[model samples]
Target: MSNNRQPDWDPRSPAVFDDQIAAYDRMRGRCPVARSDYLHWSVFRHADVLRVLEDHGTFSNVVSRHPSVPNGMDPPEHTAYRALIEPYFAPERVRAFQPVCRGVAADLVGQLPAGGGVELMGGFARDFALRIQCAFMGWPAELHEPLRQWTHRNQEATLSGDRAATAAVALEFDGFVRGLLDARRKAGNAAPDDVTTRLLRERIGDRPLRDEEIVSIVRNWTVGELGTIAASVGILAHYLAAHPDLQRRIREDPSLLPAAIDEILRIHAPLIANRRMTTRAVEIGGRRLEAGARISLIWASANRDEAVFGDPDEFRLDRDSAHNLLYGAGIHVCPGAELARLELRVVMEELLARTRAFALMPDKPPVRATYPAGGFTSLALWVERCS
Candidate 1:
């Protein structure tokens, strides 16, 4: 609930959107907790972000008027839905998904040009996300392009801060999920026993789950899959392309990849920030605020905080990973983190194994993606196929 008080900074300004990580870095040092009209209040420091993460009771996740399924719930209700979805990402499930995940990665990697200029973001990284996510959900290949367009529209609406448009886009997505659910229901016992089908059968209480509830659950999964996975791939690919020697070294010893990917993403986060709302009056970073205060925990800044990492850009495989806020933390920590990590590791392995080398094109620099998306909008890399 920000008011007519002088705002600290503009989050949607050209300066901030140009390079969100650097802008967040500047904010972390200047004002650890600053108020802005766009984001209300943004928590920039690692310590403050950690505090908010640990104290979920004080900083509620019910920040939006629109329901965000489990992500927008607090405690008991969140606890139930959270527990329901946790098994889908269990270690056994992830292990089961690896071969399928690897197949998707390899297919996408094979589509990369041989020793030529290619825009990795457009049809490659983005397509991989769409295809892999659909495959995971037991969705049809036909949904890939539609989902891509849907994701683009969703990001645009969010960036514009258009609640109506965002909700409209959300409804459109719900339609997509509902259509699939209808097909499953019509098929009944013949329906494919996939994640979506299982969700349809799940019960939240004594009553069976409703369509809206299932839609919300699928929405969360799809958004996490389509947006962050695409961004993560582009970021990892760009990082490797920009640092050929490290790329060569990782290629030489593939075992370094899992830790290396985590460290690199810690330095340049694929997901920028997430929202929270205060339930009661609280003082954070020397700033006092009342109830229903809007807060944004900037993961991009917290992970790169100099106090935590000392040298934010110093890539290392040996650093204690407990501090990395890449998948968030606490009760709200992303359920999909393990899947994300496995997906990233598999994709990078395929990308590196398939190419002899990948370097940033001399004349073509990558265009940085804006607010709702991290990584590049377009990344041109000269990729040499393995001989």
Candidate 2:
């Protein structure tokens, strides 16, 4: 109800969206925990955000009325869905997916233009994410175009803040997943053994998961797996292009890619923020929030908080990993974190191995994505594809 108050900041302003990282950095220093009519309460500090995360009892994840599988659930209810989904990203499963992931990466990097300026985001990064997601889920290539279009609609609806539009796009996605489920069911014994099929037989207590639950889980993964991976690919490539020395070093010794990837993503987070609601009155960062308060945990800011990372721009591998909220912390920490790591590492390794060098196109600067998204939407890079 207090959303009627004066706004602290316009999150969708050109100043913030044009360069999200810089704008967020300023917000962190000026007001670590801010009240915005747009975001309700935006928590910018690392410690403050971590506090909300660790204490889920005080900060609920059910910020929206729409159900979001385990992502929007807490404790007892969340516990069951979380346990059910985590095994999907277990070590064995991730290891098994490595070769498939590598093939997708190599194919994408292989498509880069020869020593010419190419728009990295649409040309390579997004394609890589789309291909990898389909491969990981055992979906057909025909679904790629539809998923791409759906992702765009989802992002637009989310940023527009139109609940009706958001719900409409969500139903469109459910239809896509339901179609896949129906095919697998009709195929019966001939169904291709993949994640979707596996999910069909999964049980919550004594009952098989309903179609709605299955669709919700798949939607959450698509939101997590597809968009973030695409953003991360662009961020990683842009960072490497900007810093040739580090890129050269990574190419020389690919062993450093994992740590380097984490550090780079720490510098520029792919996922902007996550939502939470105050279940009880709590004071955070000199501001008291009443119960039912809507909160936005700005990962884009927290990961780069100067207090934790000491000179957020400096790239160093020696820093403590525990403090990096790149994948977040606490009970609701990303269950698919291992899968993300495996995918990124495989992609980077293949990219470095395939390319001699890549540099930003001086003439065409990168175009930053607006709110509800992170990283560049268009990145022109002069890619020197290796022989």
Candidate 3:
């Protein structure tokens, strides 16, 4: 594989880091299928991305050498693990957790400042995500701070592209999960009957899942839940604050929250992109890619493609949901979509129900999160609580 193609874009550039959504939008128009030094090949258009996703044989999910549970697997192997993981997010399971999720949301919303500016990301969004995830996994409150810090470190290591740093952070996370597993094992039958403990008992092919497998599965779930859920919260709140009319409509009609939440997330994606590797030479978006080429599905851009959606930023409740790739499509669609939906819907319901209105703080604007992260890193909003 001789390399002679000039880079189409620099994914690590300061401009991309400043506003990833806008940058991706530009890329989608300029070069739907792009090549870069860091990301290798990036897919931007909705149709092109859907093509890659549908044809998993050509564009494989086994992009990483490291194990990623089901996310990094393909075919029969992916199918088995997906079956094992799907039950955890079954409709019944997600419905059962609604109360717990609502309780966490209500508590966080109630803690918002009475009449002044509030940094939604720190003061409310992050805490809500942390609490709900810990509760779902039967983890102790003590793990909240550590997990939050771990998420930050993981993102930093990923952005730096320092393999050693990324590996070190991953090991730190594994250590945390391993300790929990050991404690649960020691407790025997007395162990809490939760997702984590249940995973320890899950069997694959007539034998119990190995410790490493369990860690990987749990790590995948934790990362998705913590990062996307938190980013989604901030994005939702910011959208509502910026669009007071839609906010008021949702506040008046709580039934619209679910659809509205999905639409808002589509406009500004939480999880930026997913990786894939081309198994064979293929042509996509008029660009020829050789075998073993790395692919990055830019969800942030694909969901907002003008070809699919007339105006990427337009807020429409009646739009078709199937076209939205917020949870993705095809074999590798998000397993926890129902759980994520329930979490987002519950939190927004509580917030809107509790407050008359919340508006963006003019003096303190939000700082958009860098690449590998979506939504605001810090969002300041002025709240007007219900009297």
Candidate 4:
């Protein structure tokens, strides 16, 4: 996997995840808009990422005619679906789920080794986030394990760059989500407050949304929420543990945890790239992009661009310009972003409030994902609780 990275960089090194500052620093000007047969033309500069996202007409989100629910659709259709689902992830709704998210975090963290030694990723990161998503979306708890397994499998298949496998997994996941939607409809009227109930009853494009569309939105969301949120917890814990002073400051004042989490996500976005298709001939970085060219907006690289963010490699919790492209830009930005933020904040508060410190084992290094999914694979930590 490391060898697949640009010849100049080595992400395979265990130390890189622990210390990505140097690698990202070296990548800025060298290959800002690199083209690869596997991932296509990856835009690393902040300006390029923003331009690709902002110019929907030139670089359409509807890439390869993929069935990505509304994510693949441009304005109008995209706008309609966004209207239907955006409210569900609004600030107030995120706030409403805080208690549930907090409870889930506290329960999981409490079950960890109080004195020390816990695999932060699998121990609590993956399971807890999956459970929380289940409760929030009115999905059954029994499906958590199955859903987690499916998320990992689908990610691997998609990253393999295999069209057949990606399609197979997509169909399987869509079926699972569709079953849930069907059950909701048969049971008649949502219990008044569930997201599925609302989605089932909503209308899009002059008519009610199809069951498959609802399934696609819910499936994409759950898969993303579970993996990214879980991986983020590991990243947050690792960074905090490595910097005791920052940990101490955050422990002393919980208010800083949210800002700290945002900074952490901005600095280490779990996602790698999102694809866009060029509509016509265009120029980028003095290169001509012909019509129908597939481009990848590399958020991981763009988030670290020095032009928009001074001293971009440094992880400053109080960075004045943290408008990182981690959550993407423009209209197609993640609708569940606020929900993700709230979940991270609550989890960080719980972990920090309970554990005094966490340390990576001297000899054992953390695991990381391959090209497409870029984040921690395993985060083993030694927990120290406050007396």
Candidate 5:
């Protein structure tokens, strides 16, 4: 890597932000592995992205100088933390949490105006994510608005690429989690037996987890649940609104909801990209890159790569599920995959069951979210309630 070599692309260009998916599709075609001043090297094609994922030794997940728990660590360390976190989303745990999840979904769906227009993002999607996250973590309702604001600030900081602002946001989140831990510690024997309290008791390497480690672990779960879950809700709703036929099919057979949700998300990803740093000199997509180069696995593009998915946008449940990188792949695959799937499926099922039909409002077009975020910013749809 040298300052002399010009940037292959500008990730922040106005054109790219205007419609990220379309731009990434073009990039996958034109420059599968491209470099930018902001992101260094971006691997867009499915095959190339898979290559990076499978060989974690070469493309390391520890991209940030700041700590990111298991996400920012390499093997052995990543393995231990990952093992500790996985049980929280285990099948039985996820199943036990279903009633609470469904209640949250049902309550939000009930709030939708009967047979009327609603802005899905604000009125439904974000609310569902916030409520479900708080309920899962045993957080109070009072924290929702603050957490919502924090999520917005975090996203803004990430998109701005301002390290100071990002750090400030991280500190703000840490304060919130630290307060929860402090209260639980003071309560001691009387503390609510919940996920947050349980984290305080977790042991790593024959010692109780440190406050910072607990904060990082909780922060990771919060970010994944709040951001991706919210984005997925909006994306799924908007997709269904635009495709009435698929909507009807899913409604007719609720069992199809799970596969439908996965297929739709694969077509239009909720997560944009994930970062990896090159551990050593490597060649990808016919490009030479030196060790220590930063890399972005562009999920927004890779999942829809025509090389693997044929038409890319074609909706087909029969497609091989393994090829879909909705929750990613390799060692860093999303630990909360099962939890996410359950949340998406339950919410969509409740929504479809409650509404007769939902379609895009002819007068109000949905706005696409910018980079570091995916899905709609605001989606207006007309709902026809079941009579």
Candidate 6:
């Protein structure tokens, strides 16, 4: 192992995001595990990423859990919160949201004309995600535009990694959630049940959750879902447009769409990496990470690890590698992962069913998001709008 420590891998590198198929391959060879001041120590290999996620005692998720939700908690306490929250995102709940998700996608698709094209990122991706999030959480429709604006600003601030900006966004998100919580409380049990209602009534340890904790949990789910789902949708759309045969296959047999979604998520995980702190000294990929140190587990790199995912560079929709770390692994695995899958499945299904073809504008540069998020910044597709 090299004695030199370098800044954790930078996603801003064009070579990594733009030329990803090649970038991760070379990095795994030269530096499977690199250290960065910004992301702390990063683990690129699949085994290492799995180890960190599974061993919560040694590698703490609590470091980032201040915004609450079980994501920031380790086992025991984490397990309890997950038990309360998981059922809300279970298969039945996800199934319930499918129609609503498809309606949202159909509405967006209807807005595009047969001969015209639109920037899929802002028009379709963001709007679809926002609508589904608000519907699932049962928030008022009036807050949609402001909530969308806040979501965008919050993502920008977090990716910029400015402490003040991140703090500001957090406060803004909390305030918005607090207002909603107050309204729900005033409505009392007479109001229909929704995620907010369940959260307010559920107990974590002894009594019902404190208002701040409720705000934190809701904030985590809302903010985290918005950007990631939007980016993932954009990525899948970009790929399907680039590869027509695969698109046709998915369209002909909707069964293939779900598998295709998993493969796409594995290939282009929306987030570049997530941070975790070490609670105790631990050896990962032969390097000893000391306690109090932060580590960035590069999910994109890990998903493409040659050792685990054969032909890691190619996009094979039928690969049996269902264990990809896209939603992550172990305890802090995404709480809304099933919901995300449902959203992707419904959107892809509707898009393919409605349209037979799409055209990517030539020579127009596709903007790439750096670090925190993945996928194209502005993916404008000349979609063949259906009747």
Q: Residue 380 in model 2: shift from native, Å? A: 0.5
| Tens digit per residue, CA lDDT, model 6, 13-84 | 657656654565676777787875555677788888888887888888777636566777777878888888
Tens-digit lDDT track of model 5 for 354-385? 99899999899999998788998899999986
For model 4, the stretches where C-alpha displacement exceeds 4 angstroms are 1-25, 189-193
Best by lDDT: 3
Worst 10 residues of 6 by lDDT: 2-11
**Per-residue lDDT of 326-349 in model 2, one digit per residue for the tens?**
898998999989889999999889
Model 2 clashing residue pairs (backbone): none
Question: Least accurate stretch of 10 residues (summed lDDT) in model 1?
Answer: 1-10
By lDDT: ranked, best first:
3, 5, 2, 1, 6, 4
Evaluated against the true structure, the overall lDDT of model 1 is: 0.89
* Candidate 1 structure quality by residue, lDDT tens digits, 1-387: 233377999988889878888898899998889998878889989999999999989999998777778999999899999999999999999999999999999988888777798989886888888888998899988887788889889888987888899889988999999999999999999999999999998998898899999998899998878888888999999999889899989999999999999999999888888999999999999898789899989998999899989989899889988999998899999998899999999999999999899889879988998775788888998989775
Off-target runs (Cα >4 Å) in candidate 2 are: 1-4
lDDT of 4 by residue, 1-387 (tens): 122234334444455445444444455587666555555566778888888889999999888555677788888778878888888888888898999999999988788886867878878888877899898887878888788888788878966778999989988888887777777767875344587778888887678888778877887788778778887888888888778888888889999887788787777777767899999988886556789888877777788777877766477766754377767879988888888888888888998887868777767788766565666777778888665
What TM-score would each prediction reach against the true structure? 0.97, 0.97, 0.97, 0.91, 0.97, 0.94
Cα lDDT of model 5 overall? 0.91
Error in Å for residue 306 of model 4: 1.7
lDDT of 3 by residue, 298-380 (tens): 99999999999999999999989999999999999998898999999999999999887899988898999877789989999
Q: Candidate 5 — which residues are off by over 4 angstroms? A: 1-4
| Weakest ten-residue segment in model 3 by summed lDDT | 1-10
Model 6 pairs in collision:
6-35, 7-36, 8-35, 8-36
Q: Residue 162 lDDT in model 1? A: 86
